[model samples]
Target: MRRSVLVAVMAIVSTVAAGCSSDPTDPAPTTSAASASPSGKPTDISFLVYGAPAEVKAYRSMVKQYDVDHPGVKVHLVEVSSADAALRRLRKGEVPDVFLMSRRDLGEIVDAGINQPIDELLDSRGVDFTDLYKRDSIRAFSHSDRLECMPYGISPMVMYYNTNLVDFSEMAEAGLDVPKNHATWTFDQFAEAARFGARRGAKGVYVDPSLSGLAPFVYSGGGSLFDDDRDPKRLDLASDGSLEALTTSLELLRKGAITPTPRELRSTSALDLFKAGKLAMMAGFRTLTPELRRTPGLSFDVMPMPALPDDRTLGDASGLCISAKAVNTSAAADFVVHAIGKDAVSDVAAAGYMVPANTEVAESDAFLQQDRMPAHAYVFNRSVKDIVTLPLIESWPALERAVHGDVYQLFYSRVIDIEALTKKIDEESKAVLSPPKASVTPSPSASASGKN
Candidate 1:
């Protein structure tokens, strides 16, 4: 259940997605500055984000428009498929002027010094910065203290179910009132119910490898990821509370509840399986929620991730950040600010995702005025308010690579003991962030990205 973060998987086909082609309602954008940046020159901003080339193409189009409208700014788009690739580029000084990345990736950049503080830029323009969603608007920078990044688009966790495979009537027969679409339920109850669906022959539920689907358990189970001050971002993984949270996922897998799929599918197309009616409950973020509605044969909607015994604080955090070395910092800032304001927020809401990150966007007619949201939408919102992004300290990426490599081994290999697994991970993390033992503590704060 510790396997969760504010960022979720979204395999949006850039060429066709709301990214590349501008919708009519989209605000007009061009790359021109009303005045010269203090730097006194047009900026050449290189933007990097994760996705296939198609997505990058869409970003390129928008960035190109930004460059054109702003006489002094030029933009470049760089695409990478995995978090590792992005890190490598940052380490090699091949970093772009600006970057578009997941919160997880931004955490890595924050330590690398690849991220530039944005306050000065905002101060320069005298922009008040009050129009954004409070959660995304503030926590993004607050998560790491010192305001490291901003949120561009956000997708919250959602519960996706395949009604065809699940017989809601069984609950009625058992005197259990099964919740209808968009209805909320507790984690314990949901697990019990998923077992019900499993007994009836449907894959009761699935948790893809991505963090989006797992963090809810931590919050709902009364587990806290870290102590008050996030100095040593400790692993509450084995906490008794988290153990209870972990049991939910463990139960689903042990009961033969879900058909195993490759992690790549979880990242790229797990929704396709849910749409195929292969699952009763598929935990995912908003990006995967709409397919349940769009698919003719599937009846499903969004729901909260679920609550554990007395647990309540769900991990959630998202924000957009401009690259420190961005050739066009001012122009990039404009795009990010605008994207956070209205246009991009609308796209996110219209796509059936969570409320927009912009305060106005969330309250707009498009958000508040909508009715009959997919199942789980409201519950999901309840958790979204208290979201905690994974700590993005300097060693996080290295720590992530180590944990990712080890967790799969432990899950699949029976020979490894839990103690041994934890030991291996702890040692790796400590080594990566070597504490100050009279000079042994290698600063997790490595040089800024693009410095090579």
Candidate 2:
């Protein structure tokens, strides 16, 4: 589920599970490893990133801001080649004082007891951890429903195409509106355009469902992820809406829209095909964020992920985590809060690293529709509510890898009926997402240092 962009070009979609990266806190473990020196005088803090240089730069700049303002805390930025590597370092007790990691997997690290909590620190800092993102998102890090992690940066999904490659003329011939940032379309129209691309010596789209780009498909189709209104974690993998979402994705593949031709998927990578502009509608996923779009030759635009049978948008958020082992809890917490604050939001958004997570940043005049990047900013406004909300089940490691992998298999196998596939997914999901029945166990050490 995690690997470098060099290993898999589909890393854009792979953002859902871009996998492990190196942690600056410790060296690569040979047979075994040791923890960071607790004896350092400067109070060194380590931050890991599974993101591009631009993001690293943005993160560094923000940290510098904290340094300038606080003047006492020292922060270290460790460029981890992947996210998983950082997690490994954390488990081995060699991770940075603060992870600054992205995704729910960070929450998994907290569950494993390697990280510390920062609620008290946040409260003292006047930062509203809960308000940074939607309520449900906060649950990603909850231990016994207490805060686990806070959202750092978030972006909405959209449709991205190499405009030079799409034949808008042909779209006019078919009376299609050539969808824009605000203008969405039905799956039928999307399929038609994809088939049109294929007929004209193109691959239509490169939307491998196994990637992060698959989020909106589930949401726009009106799918519910996990049934969490109870004590058990039940997955609704095969609900009518979910099944429709899955089937539509599969149908697009069959119609020559989403690719990796059953064979290419087995061999070549979706990112390779997409980078070649052979893909028509990538239906941009997490990459809609600025840090990602600025990657060297991405030469793409941010269009809202196509609408489903109903019009809905999908948004996703992942961010830096303050390790339970965090020593400079004050410094780490301050940096994360500022990163999502109004001060840095506009710059991050304008830089196109990711959609700014700040309410003000997303609506800033700088982000308003522009000539160079017309479809760039509207994503968050429309899709925030519709994100194929990330699954909260702790086995996300196993569930995301297993269930998602199998769903893709079913798409290619075409052996099981959609209904059967849905049923199997439902049964397996219920088992996988089920939560504990009793009150959550108390945290190992209740010494939280977060500020609100």
Candidate 3:
């Protein structure tokens, strides 16, 4: 009964996974053929996908195109409301030959003993791994260092500043400089400008306490919250870099240079205030671009997370995953390859959906010219060299919750001592992450592997 309930919950929600920070000590990924064999050619197979209307439409078009190119193969596309819905179908014996999902979801799928690695499939079909731009993204979906997903979207967290509230002219008059090049912007500069903006009748910078929003500050300062994502015991949030990041944020809050004041630390509120022109600066990923362009009377631009020198930000990718239970693995792998191929990636980018994971496609003008509203859309790729992927840890969801609980406490005035709070986070996170652990509510069950 417990296993059945866990599987049902896993079928209902595909949680949004947090990303990893920069790591130099990590080993490189090895490309080897998987042991699983692709099923022989078949005329029919299920293909499941989930997304908003436009994204769904975009994928349907791609599938149609693939059908047109393949004479004998017929791929049936199922549009589900969520990854959970599709997985529920899969569990009920409606297994899909190919499915679209976040790379983060790979762990749960692996844990359930469902999907097969695509290494051998790629080799058999001659899919070149080098064609993908973000190798880190590909690695994110791997289990025991074997590929299980074909990456499509590379979403990097970036800073969006409202020009209306920012008043660059006012900043210039106040002898403050706008960040023309993100590489040189420091935490001191960010805080100073926020204070200036606050005095000028604009709310200063506001960051939601989520790991994605908070990690950039830690990363820009050259600190890491976790050393090895795979190691439940590893923590560096108390390190000098982490301390500096936290201290700067607290100081800014105390000085009235930021918002979500201990009382307003709500995630959605940051975007709401940003759109209402109440905020001068906010942070988010490329996913926010389309919706941001739809807002009226807002002049905004995108920039890499401002840093002391070579800055970094959280990176995540979503793409195609094939099931081990797939009856036609050959056709499934073919569709997977086609879905992330040059033509398909170009179409996805042209729609301004996301940054393609293909090297040539990402560098193409299709994505770069997709919008002019964020005059600095080009800068989205400028920091490609600094993209960091989150580790593929089964314990991530539990650790994320434990860490975020403390973050909200600190942001909301419930926690005054930053050091003490972070230490508590480290403790709670270890308890959640430790193997052979005591009983916990979530219990690292099917949904525990699911996003949330």
TM-score to native of every candidate shown: 0.69, 0.72, 0.79
lDDT, candidate 1, 135-191, per-residue tens: 443445533234456555455565666655555676767876565644456665676
Looking at candidate 2, the ten consecutive residues that score lowest on lDDT are 1-10
Q: Please, what are the lDDT tens digits per residue for candidate 3 over residues 154-265?
A: 7777778886666557777778866656444656667666766564555777766666667777777777767555543545677777877767766665444456565454
The RMSD (Cα, Å) of candidate 3 is: 10.3
TM-score of 1: 0.69
Number of the top candidate by TM-score?
A: 3
Q: Indicate whether candidate 1 or candidate 3 has the larger lDDT.
A: 3
lDDT of each: 0.53, 0.55, 0.65
Q: Report the number of backbone clashes for model 1.
A: 33
Instruction: Order the candidate numbers by TM-score, best to worst.
Output: 3, 2, 1
Per-residue lDDT tens digits for candidate 2, residues 341-421, read 666666555555465444555666645535544444565455655554454335455665656755666556656577876
lDDT of residue 244 for candidate 2: 81
| Model 2 quality (TM-score) | 0.72
Could you tell which candidate, 1 or 2, scores higher by lDDT? Answer: 2
